[model samples]
Target: MSLAELIDQPEFGHHESPRHQTRRVLLLGNDDRVLLAVARGLGRNGISVDVAWCDPDSPALKSQYVHAFHSVVPYSPHDDQWLDGLHRLVKQYDYDLVIPCNDYAVVPLQLEREKLDPDTHWYLINDDAFQVAFDKAKTSRVASELGINVPRECEITDADVRSGFSNREFSLPDRRSLRFPVYVKPRSSITASDVTNKRSAQRVDSPDALAEYLIHEFPHDGVLIQESFSGVGIGVEILAHQGKVLMQIQHQRLRETIDGGSTYRETIAELPELTEATRKLVQHLNYTGVGMFEFRYNRETGDWVFLEINARFWGSLPLAIAAKANFPFALYELLVKGQTNFHTNHTIGVRCRNLINDLRAFRHQKAEEFDLENLLFGKDYLDFYAPDDWRPQLATLVHFARSVLGKFTRRIGFSV
Candidate 1:
């Protein structure tokens, strides 16, 4: 039966549709790991999947399940170059949905959802809500309003940003109260107009360094200075629609970089307090799609502090899928089929690793850093490698070789 015919039937997601007719999906703006994880799940489920990305060397391109590849700009503010390409893809082909992978694409899609047909299953949100989730300052406000526990924060005002710190002077009233060694993060990941990359929060150890850091990043709006917490990283992965949460999964870091993103993690059923906080935050935003409410948790005499939110799919997506959460398929069913086949419970203590990054982190352990021992060997559901889909294994090696060569050649003063 034709896809249109099959979809119109009452039992689309049911077992009746054999060789399920084309339900074309486009995965865009997600990083390599997330893209591969999502693509593999949906493709295996009889969806015709295409990948559109800005990076040529992305590992997702080598996935055996991908039907086709296209190059597209990640985001554009003043022009429709990126938007136009996306429009053509959806219009030319009756794509079931376009899943945005990261903030770079989510920001633009949220800003221009009307052009993309607001009624479609584009996995988008209104710009106002995006601000609350994407902007740290706004997230703090909303989290606090929801009575979710969040870290102590200090705001950087417009007047402070307007007064250039190049002269090494900017007014910070909270500086006296703030304990040294705090985190200074851009209010939003897309700090600059260009949206070049997902911005990183840095640790500034002292007042002079903090001033210098702000001076360097002067023009970007609303940089947040927050109290740093030393604790284990926790992620509450959730999927919601119109303020109703569908499914929630929890994972805690086994090994993580000093900044963010865990290289090695295992699904864990942690505190119920965090679960309550996550549900409140998602419902408060009336969040309309998949999101990860990231937190930092202290063991004793403290609880989960709302760190930030990933308004899209997260890097540890593979781990979630391995735990049988299957977020990609769940999201697809919710958007395309108009109903979610919920996985009532996700497996706990299922460890997953990004082998490459884990090894890199171990190789270059910094001074006074947590040692990574016996982590290099792991058979527990590798992130980039699948037993059936082994193409990424070769593609990843070639890409890594090129990256290392480029770095080495640059040291000798030449671009590879």
Candidate 2:
């Protein structure tokens, strides 16, 4: 019997034949803005969308768009329970499609893909494409090969770190090519087996700092150390089918924290150079899904460096919908309706802000980063609010209140 058969037997779910029903999709993720965005997008479009994640946030589960919420084991390459649960869920409910919302779901779906039903539709990329896209060093090399300018980067491979591990001596052999301040990032966002691998990239200034980071991180597979530049982060989002670009848009980060996507962003007209390079990159990957190619563009010099790619539905997905790009809807239509014609017209100068994250970002920003006029006027989208769907927003309020109250009480207790 195949590994898939052992993972999903008739005893688990196959025995019960699920009667065919309306198109339904299983979204694999935790409490992410993209999950809520995709859920609401698909649900409002007459497709039943269900939420499945490990240790789901309570407030996010209150979304009215969700048909059901299933908590399952988190995927670690060493474990089969999560995969088993997915197989059981798919077989029992007969999900028409499955979409991964974030890296946790994306990595697992790729590694354990064979254990799931091949005939069933899954929105994931091949391992080859994932390696090139997920690894910053590889991403830079590929971008350079395609005539796209990229920041100088060196990977601290296992070979580079073995001496450090064995004799406390480690350094990049070709470190002279890259300048400081340099940024260190795990080659892949997550490991196949390690659940606690979403370590943020760090900007290091000195050799001591780099060595300290290596001592602490112990990047087993490798870490990409790249030259850092001063510029704004720009996201070039695209939806492609079989390597053909369908539609694309670009957004500029207005207010951001160091580690994650911007809490405040505004859609702008696509830069021609970046868009052309992105098209080439997509065709090179033979990409079949919607993803964002991140870059940092310097206005002063008309220069840009390839950052990385989020090759799945990302944090700013709601912004895409607000701009009329509607990636989730496009994905569903592409697969379910066999529709390929997508109009690439997107409204520019639209801003999106996750109120909660924006509020936090505001606390950490300099005066220049905050935009007063755009905050008050222009096309804007608050990440978690819709007139029709007020329940999730309400849940967010409740959760926020509790969190504040808990923090205050803890402070008081400590003082007393």
Q: lDDT tens digits, residues 269-318, model 2?
A: 87998898899999998998888999999989989988888899888888
> Among these predicted structures, which one has the highest lDDT?
2
C-alpha TM-scores of all predictions: 0.86, 0.89
lDDT digits (tens) for residues 82-186 of candidate 1: 777777666665578888887666677777777775544687765666878888889987888888887777888668756655654333454556777788888
Segments of candidate 1 deviating more than 4 angstroms: 1-20, 117-120, 161-176, 366-378, 405-416
**What C-alpha lDDT do the candidate models reach, one value each?**
0.75, 0.77
Candidate 2 regions exceeding 4 Å error are 1-19, 164-177, 368-379
- Looking at model 2, report the run of 10 residues with the lowest lDDT sum: 7-16
For model 1 the TM-score comes to: 0.86
